[model samples]
Target chain A: MKYHILIAFFLLLTNLNKGFAGGGEGHGQAFDPAGTAIHHISDGNVYTILDGIGVTLPLPVIVYVPEKGWDMFSSGHFHPGHHEDGHHAYNGFVLHHGSIYRVTDPTFPAEGSVEVQGFEHELENNGGKDKDVYYVNFNGTKYRLDARSTLDGGVLGGGITSFYDFSITKNVVSMILVSLFLLWLFISAANAYKKNPNKAPKGIQNVIEPMVLFIRDEVAVPFIGKKYPIFLPFLLSVFFFILGLNLWGQIPFLGSVNVTGSLSVTMVLAVLVFIIVNVNGNKHYWGHIFWMPGVPGPIKILLAFVEVMGLFIKPLTLMLRLAGNISAGHIAILSFIGLIFIFGKSGESLGGSVVGSVVSVPLTMFMMAIEVIVAFVQAFVFTILTASFIGAATEEHHHDHEHEHGHGHA
Target chain B: MTGTLAALGAGLAVIGAGLGIGMVGGKAMEAIARQPEASGDIRSGMIIMAAFIEGAALIAILLSILMA
Candidate 1:
């Protein structure tokens, strides 16, 4: 059974290699490891499962133009070609690298599908800063493409643009899929417990019960005290939600969706935790933040400022830690695989390719092993920090005298 | 020039984080050795401290990337 499983694992690895190879089908252009790594980590509208097999799952594209009104269509209308570049544009919106961009020039058709010649990216100086400007070619004329509007107000080089993309992206799909899977697993396990109340845990129950108990015993109870039961559900949801997404991204042939690696997703999760913790904050938490009971008047003001900053920084760190770690892991794995193309001189040398594969396969495997551990560690860390924050916020004031005495002794 | 500096900054941040996490792990090991029964608590505490240090380093790295 072990041998069979190992053989299946090798087969999956080979399939992964084929998928990557298909995406990197640049004829003579130099292999761009950094760009490739970034592209792989970025969320996409079209989900390409096995690029070698040309199997892409289309997602719905919903965009809103300020004056042009709402336009909805399947991303398949883009006829995504190599590198997820669209062969055709639907209603003036072209898909480039799996992202939809609108052609601003009036010369391009506004209502119907049109065949696009190609896409071009140029570095243009915008207000003393160099920025990538994308253009789509149609009827031999290159029209500048406006990216989807971002709420960053151009601070991140994305501002109020021609359109707003409210599409079901790859990350969104992955989150839905993972959530549904978790729901099924948990519901079935719950049923098992209900049906066999006297018997020992089995199958999925065995897998989940230990983790639930660990969090309840080690994290929730110790940190949150008697109020653990109230927050246990939220903590479990956060832990399992993150763990499921992290593991989902680790799968070899499942589009390698980097759901947890995305900053926006992590930001939302952090925002949820922030809201929950603040809303649940007792009088002691608010008092400590606004005016500490024991500190000097001058120091109380200084400390309040620091404490308020700490409140924001806690959630900010939570967001960055999860996204940074997951993204770094994905980038490391991709860079290792890029070693093959680097050594092969973009497939010009057979011996170089062989050596590169020999070196990178083991390295990639080791990195994947580390990533599995990271998947658990990061989820655990996020949960523990969240619990600690909650514990601090909801802590009773009965121990105030004890804490003061301890500080006096120190 | 900016790219080079960004790389240097990121490397420096990693170095600091490496040293910090190394110390946390080392001390945790010593604590575990002294009290084998409390290893679980020690290990978890070590991880939390290491994560805090890593968070600071990650912020630095992110700033460097944005600057680049």
Candidate 2:
């Protein structure tokens, strides 16, 4: 368990290394407000076209925007069923090619705020000028921005502010909680070990003991070989770090929170795995990747090129897969909650609301519960795969006696 | 209109998959319980088989989502 805490210390060191090496830039800047991390500018404006199908459609455009706040105005984000009695409800936006869009800020008719043209938000919405932008209040700081999307009709929303209340809108608060929890966890584990180094690990150790041992014996030992001890620290760190974040992300508001979903965070994890895998890869492993064992010389050369590309592609796939799976789940659950309005606005007569409202309850509940398993499974898959990659890179694949002596660790 | 039914179907499919995985795991444990020494070998098979089941179910859910 103390080992898990040491991973936190490594996290601190890497962060400090990042701070000293080149300040926060690019992928290193997920939590950084200055960069395009969680904060995204969305294109695709929302429009409430009353003609077709009696439903307002949210249209999205794939383009780039200077600020993340501008995504609120994209048509792809239109909430067609957002209406509620006399309250300000949504009436536009549709799913086109798996993305949402709508007229950005169609209801914010404030005199000083921005306005929209026939199909765009420009100076016309703000008095008489075009390009009048709106500000999103974070904590208390206001972020200004414009909408951007992709060429294939997808709004790219980015830019996130942590000013909202610590428990509500602040990711920093959640991170601090994680850091403090990690500190407490480590200290407790260390104290336990200090009192009795080999007493079967009591208390929290009881739960974590099996898992830590599992990673080393199950994941690290076979793939990493004798150097498993050296890499054990990093592997254990990643498992717990991700597991902790995963569990935390499941904690109600905190669970709904997007920590690991941030590209910056995923990028950092991928880079760490990349560094460790490359730094520790043995000779025969690199040889196999670059030079096949039994193939034509020309084919071997081609395979070598592909193998080299595999290095980056492998980690990239891992990062995207993890981030996409988690984020899509979060968005889907929230979208379900947004469905009640759709039925109401579509004039479905209040009857459907009962089923929609009642059914979503269990659905969302089930989703929340499943997310727990997903959290653990994803973390395990990542840790296991990382170890596998390292094992593959450093060791040659054994076909003849692979399973005859599979249980026997290398 | 049918999205509701599709969601319910998605839930059922995942639940079925989850149950299938549980059966595979439970059986593995039972076999291990019967033969403690073969736990390692049985466990490996269990994990691989479990992964296949999970992959199948996950695909089903994905298809369900796309269809829905």
Candidate 3:
């Protein structure tokens, strides 16, 4: 009861103090889970919609329909408005100065077909302030992606969006590159294993074999006992798969998705581990959790409830921890950078940017290194836990030696 | 404030878990050096405990992330 009261008090206090937060709080920008005061949604940290060819023809309001292709795993784009119905409805892209523009029919442009109108500024292109309607091609059709200057010398929209766009982004391209590298690395490792099954292991084999051996002997051997070899591959696979994903998260642009941060993703991983452990566990393990070895029957009944619940708690925690830590790091780093924009609007903006950027540099770099280690460590920990949990279930509930020796009578 | 606090709490939670695992890993490595063959049993147990500790941190992080 006391604990509950304390929790309630804390929650109340937190709710009371939530006034300063920006509307976008906890959207996962890192440094400030709350929205930063400096950078509004108008800021360029996120992408905006385009009505036409150039990033011109200002669209003060562009509606975002959570189209079928929405990727929840990503931090995506959304306009800054709302209707009475609470839908993010906007007509195609509305121009500034009260002009509403509607989207045309489907067209995916080809290379080098659309004509480029000379020297006009699109909202996206901080290029130059001129009036131009430029055309660009994607597949074969010519499409306009430009921004226009209103009659009042104000800039319109500055985003160049495509109708049929799925696989294109500066960051995503880099992700592809990093993915290729991982593929190569794994393939090389696999080839090394295949090529040198015997004889003194060579370069890659030497480095890899020790880790493999360590997992086999340390993770599998004891927990799974005589059948350890059968599970070695699984342990190794989990370790490598997680490590690979974690490392992928760190790649310059491609290393996105706090894969370790996404709770759902982590939950799935943890659940899988849980299933594997229970399914493979020996009969004794279930007996221990449900019916115990030597406890009095009365006590055993109480223990069973605790034991079954404990199983769910263990994996749930595992999933939450990994996803939380990974995502938190990303949000923190982004928030640090975001402070510049928030403070940039004020007199203290200079000091704010300098301090924010400076402090964030060393701190983030240090954290990044720690993150790499964590990626591996967490993976190893999870694998081992699974091994142990399975081991516990399989191993005899009571010690054979203790039973034989009786009450300390050696 | 809520999100920031959540993130902060999560970070701190992971630190404790990290510290515990670090200690366990250090000792396990040390034990392995003194008795190489016993390394097998020592490592398995160490990993189990470390994972449990990590699970606590993981829970904190997941909750924080969800809140965010």
Candidate 4:
């Protein structure tokens, strides 16, 4: 066991050295820790396992432009070179930094593959704010590139662009993989139960039974009450889906896909929860929000305003909390690993690299362990909060008599 | 610089979150010690409350990151 563990650590260090080397090679720039960390966390078009080893899995590229219509092709057509930057442009779309961008210049070739020089980043002032604009060099002419449109309305520095990317990105691939694995696991467990009838639970059934029971007994029963059965499936699905993705992201050498860490993903989940909670809200829930019983007229209106804000704020917080926790964990781990490059001065000093490795390995290991616990905690938190929201909305109110009794006692 | 200020804001938010979670964990520990059998219930409750506090701090940190 000890020898195996030692061998594993040695292999990990070698891979880490190679990964760092690959990241710093083509840029000819000083190691930028923040940029590297952000890049690793962000979604990408191509799945890179170990860049230094040149092991990359190509994903499908799907994009749409108003004038060009829909274009679908394999991302491998770009012949992703160093840093996953495309060495060629396919149908005027260039892959840079693992994202697809369209060349907007009219003179640029609109059809067929063309060898491109490279990509350059420049700070361009748009109105009052300075934005990072990207340009592609093709045939010795610099052509401005438009990023895939985002629905953030420029709040996150992304707005409507010339095209839309509907590609099977790294995150999408991870979600599909996780969802399939979960389906297989649960279906097998269900089958085992059916075959055994009343026999003692065994195999996969044993693994899943306790978690389902825990959610049902602890979260659903206490919060949702008699209607627990109605919401049980939804709660279970949310919990396991999150937990699966969290654990999946924690795995090393698997592209480090940050599905839950992405704000867009979490925003979708929050929106779903928001819609479900609001739709299921009973008369009492609406009453509490619009007008509290027995309150003064003016104060009731004031309270209503605050209550309405809370309704929106709850889901907003839910979105931010999960994404923030997961992303922070990923960033912390990346930063710890980055200490090697920083201390080694980007491999200028072998002794510094050794010293950095000695310090970083243990810290990275510790952070990974903490991340495992966080994966569970965040999953539980999301599910329990959802349960609480549903519970509050569907709860039957008998508080009026209790309020009067409490007042009399006081 | 604006970057420095954003880092400072994120640090401040972490401080607040640290203090808040520390209190929640401390009180929960005290509660569990007083009634060991109720530890399960208290633990979940503590986590939920800590998550709420974390949500507030996370929003602030996110704003700081955006500002930077």
lDDT of model 3, residue A268: 71
Q: In DockQ terms, which candidate is top?
A: 4
Per-prediction TM-score: 0.93, 0.54, 0.56, 0.94
For model 2, how does the per-residue alpha-carbon lDDT over B1-68 read when each residue is reduced to its tens digit? 44566688778867987898899999999999999999976875576556545545555564554454
Residue-level error in angstroms, candidate 3, position A127? 49
Winner of 1 and 4 under DockQ: 4
Candidates in descending lDDT order: 4, 1, 2, 3
lDDT of 2 by residue, A8-82 (tens): 543332232221121122222222221111222111123222211223343333332233222233332323332
Isolated chain A: TM-score per model?
0.92, 0.58, 0.56, 0.93
Q: Which candidate has the top score in TM-score?
A: 4
> After best superposition, candidate 4 residue A54: deviation in angstroms?
2.6
Off by over 4 Å in 1: A1-27, A399-410
Residue A84 displacement (Å), model 4: 1.3
* Candidate 4 wrongly placed segments (more than 4 Å): A1-25, A125-128, A404-410
lDDT of 3 by residue, A6-79 (tens): 55643342232222222232212223334332222111212222211112211123222334232211212112
Model 2 chain A, poorest ten-residue lDDT window?
Answer: A82-91
DockQ of 1: 0.60
Candidate number that wins on TM-score, 1 or 2:
1
Q: What tens digits encode model 4's per-residue C-alpha lDDT throughout A1-410?
A: 99788656644574455455434324656777877788789999999886556577889998989997998999998998777788999998999888889888879998999999878878887775678888888878889989889998788989998999999999999999999999999999999988889899988988899999999999999988999999999999999999999999999877778999999899999999999899999888888888877779999998888889889889999999999889989999989988877877777767777677778889999999999999998999999999988888888767655443111000
Least well predicted 10-residue stretch by lDDT in candidate 4 chain B: B47-56
